[model samples]
Structures are given as structure tokens and as C-alpha cells.
Target: MGDFSALGEKLKATRNKMGLSLSDMSAKTGVSKTMLSQIERSESMPTIATVWKIANGLKIKLETLLDDSSQLYEVKSIDDKLAIKDDDGRMIIHSIFPFSPISGYEVFYGVFKPGCNYSDDNHTNSTTEQLFVTDGELEMIVGQNTYRITAGCSLSFDSSEKHRYINNGDIDANVLIIVNYE
Candidate 1:
């Protein structure tokens, strides 16, 4: 929920480059046209899922819209103030490192309340995700497979196919997810 006017401009440019209008983007991303317009107009800040949807629908990297810094020696830390949240705050995402095309990878720290998760279309077909649970339990569902990852445990898998991370436990789940794009 930070200042994302720059992001709105970038989004407008990307959409124009793709020959897409708000309605077209809405069709592709499953986001509402009004919301998409609001995003394009800098009247709204998208949630993590919205970011993923737009990136996936446009077949672009997450950082294509999120990267705002280019310092050679940037001092960055994972802070909650930078988190993007769902309306209910069930899922919170803090981007530790925004992936650059040069780096081909990104990192995120996330907190998931019970029943919270990413949408099935959260990633592209040419990436791998490695997730480490630091606090509570999570169920990583991938292509009909459900893997339970506990605190201090990790899970790595291809992200192209159907996948999502859910916290079905009673407590909140803290996780670090590293995504490597091909």
C-alpha cells in the first residue's frame, strides 16, 4: 500500500505495449476492469495476488512492475511496512529482493493466516520455487500433490504447473520463498 503511482504509469505503458485496454487486461487477468483502471490511474494499490495475476496474464516478471530501486549497493531489509496484504490481512507479502532479468531470481518473506494462499495462476511455467517455513505449518499443493512443510523445513518444486501455498493450521505461518525464473 505504498506510493505506487510509478507502478501505475508502468502498468499503463505495459498494457499499451501489449495492445490491451483495461477491459482486455481484465479478461486476461481475471481482475475487474474498474479495478484495473484504478490501478492504471494510481487510485489503487494491488495486492500480492493481483500482482501475480497481472504478471502472469502479461507473461512478465514480478519485478517488471515492482522494481523501484537500482542502486548498486542497496541496503534493503524485509520489513512489514513494505508488505502487500489482502483485504482481510490473511496473507501478507514482503519482497526482500525483486528479481531482475539479469539476476533471474527473487525472494519474498510471507505471513499467512489460516486459510490464506496464492492463486493457482500465481507463477509462470518457467520457474522454480523454494519455500522455507520458519514459524508455523503449511500445505504446499502442487499438481494434485499436497506436501506438508513444517517449521524449519523446506520444499522446492517447479512452479509452472498448478500450485499454491496454504496455511491450514490454527496459527500463522511465516515463510521465505525464493523463486528462480528460467
Candidate 2:
């Protein structure tokens, strides 16, 4: 099966394992029931933001929903990595490391165009994020605090609170982000 179909099956199985109905899943994910149903049926492809919401609602790492973890070793080039684009296509996230329940962490390489802002809701409990700015500038807001990180800078914060990444520089902002679920 294709990746999307596999993802749909996984979603359905996860929801079933959680004993959550479509309505219950919708309530938790903030995605409409119809949309969730469509996703589970592989009738619709969810956006990157939608995928994140589902992962958070399910209390699982995003990689758990993206990668087939049964493999012992996997090698992926930039072109082979799973990538998701924002609604406006201003932000792209490349899945650099797959999710492993044993490892309890996932990594992503993100690129944000100038003037792009990607806001995210709180993740599951005890989740934390580490971000390293590789190029340009990034304005990261966690809860009520904002930090400006330039190239070669890194920051870590609790991700169980609302957060936002804003690219205010004229150039694109590139970052390596790692999410840990403790």
C-alpha cells in the first residue's frame, strides 16, 4: 500500500486501541469528525498542521504516525525523507529522524520563508522541544516568552505550551528541531 493508505490504517488502529470514537477523536484533535473520518478512510490527505494535531491528540509522537518503525535501519536522503508543507507553502518540515516508542523522540528539519509564522498548540504532557538555528533568524515564542535565535544558536523549552516560530529575517530560516516525550 501507499504511504497515505498505510497512515490511514495506522490512524484507524491507533484510535481503536485508544477506544476513541470518531467524535471523541475530533474533540481531542480539534479536527472535525468528518475530516478525521476522511483521513482514516484515506479519502483525504491531511495537512502538516492537521497531522500534528492528530499526533498530539493521540498522545503519540508525530513520527509514530509517519514512519514504519519495524525496520531496524533506514537510510534516507533529502529527497527520500518525508516532507510536509504548510497550507501557504511557506514552511516545509522534513522528517529527519523517525519516531520510535523506545526512543520517545522525533527530529525534523524545518525551513520557513521570510515573514512566515507557524504556530502550534501544546503537545502531550511532558513533551519538550530542542531547536537549533542553522541559518537566518528565528523568533521562537513558547508560552508568553519570546526568544530570538540566530544562526548557530540553540534553545530548548517545554512543548506542552503553545509555541510559535516566526521568520522575521529577509532570508529563509532553517532549524533542526527535536521533540522528546518523557
Candidate 3:
């Protein structure tokens, strides 16, 4: 959200490629022309909902539009403070790489403290989630089925149903997760 220039550039390029003017885009996206102009000029930051609307109107994927980089080669480092937290910060997820159709998947590193329990909603019907426990153990409850995964083990399941993760270990549980949106 902080870097508006990249998003602005992408938005403008996509709109121009589709041969849509600001007014046409506004009507299609249900966003005002003034707001669209501001976004294109990098003077305003679009909220997640607004971005979703634009994606739907453009018939494009959310991550495709949100992705700031489409380079062939790059390196990224994750810091603890940049993690997405849940369950009152007991569980943290760091995005190694966001979803990209070119890559066919997104990568995340997660850490769950002892006694941590995190519940997540279902994803798209075609999505699958793979998790590899790097340290300690955790129980993954995918819909009605539950599985215990220990360190050095991995599990894969359809992610279209509700899922929950619980770390019963006394130590922190670390997992590498890949989400396939194919």
C-alpha cells in the first residue's frame, strides 16, 4: 500500500491496453473517474476492495494486478516484522513470493508458537495447499479430515474447504507452505 507508483503504472498500462478511458473504466469498475485518475497518477492508494473491483472489471487475477515485480530474476528477504499474524499473533506467515500464474504457485514461511491455533477460510475451488514441517510438529485439520505432521514431513490437500492448524509441541513449529492456484 505504501508504494503507489508501481500499482499506478500497472493500472494505467492495463487500462490502456484494453482501450478504456478513465470514464469507461470508472463505469466498468464502479469507481469514479476522479478516483481512477488519482490512482493512475499515484496520488492515491486503492484499497483491497477497490483493487478487487478493478481486477474483476478487467477480467484479471488479483495478485497479477497487485504484484509489484515481474522481473526474470530477483532476490527477497523476509523479516519477522513483515509477517502476517493471526490468532492474536501466535501464528505468523511470511510471504516469500506472492501468487503468480507464471510460477503456478505462491510460497510462504510460517511459524506457530506452542499452543497456537489458527483457523483459515476456504480458498478458490481449484487451489491446493502443501505444507512441510521444518521443525516441531503440528496438527492440520482440513475440513473433516485431520492429520498429524511432524518435522521433516509434508502434507498436501485441497484448500477449498476450511482448515485449521494447531501446534501441540512445546517448541515453535516452523512450516514451509506452497499454495497452488492451478
Count of clashes, each model: 0, 0, 0
Q: What is the lDDT of residue 32 in candidate 2?
A: 95
Each model's C-alpha lDDT?
Answer: 0.82, 0.85, 0.84
TM-score for model 2?
Answer: 0.59
**For each candidate, what TM-score against the reference?**
0.56, 0.59, 0.60
Question: What is the C-alpha lDDT profile of model 3 across 1-182, one tens digit per residue?
Answer: 54555888888887886778999899898988998899989898989899999888766787557776856476666763378988988898998876543456789999999989998885864488999999999999999999999999999988888999999889989999999875
Candidate 3 off by > 4 Å: 1-73
Point out the worst 10-residue segment of candidate 3 by lDDT: 72-81
lDDT of 2 at 93: 96
25-140, model 1: which lDDT tens digit per residue?
89988889998889889998999889889888876887777767453376665653488897378889888887644456888898989978765556753588899999999998
The model with the greater lDDT, 1 or 3, is 3
lDDT of 3: 0.84
Rank order (by TM-score, best first): 3, 2, 1
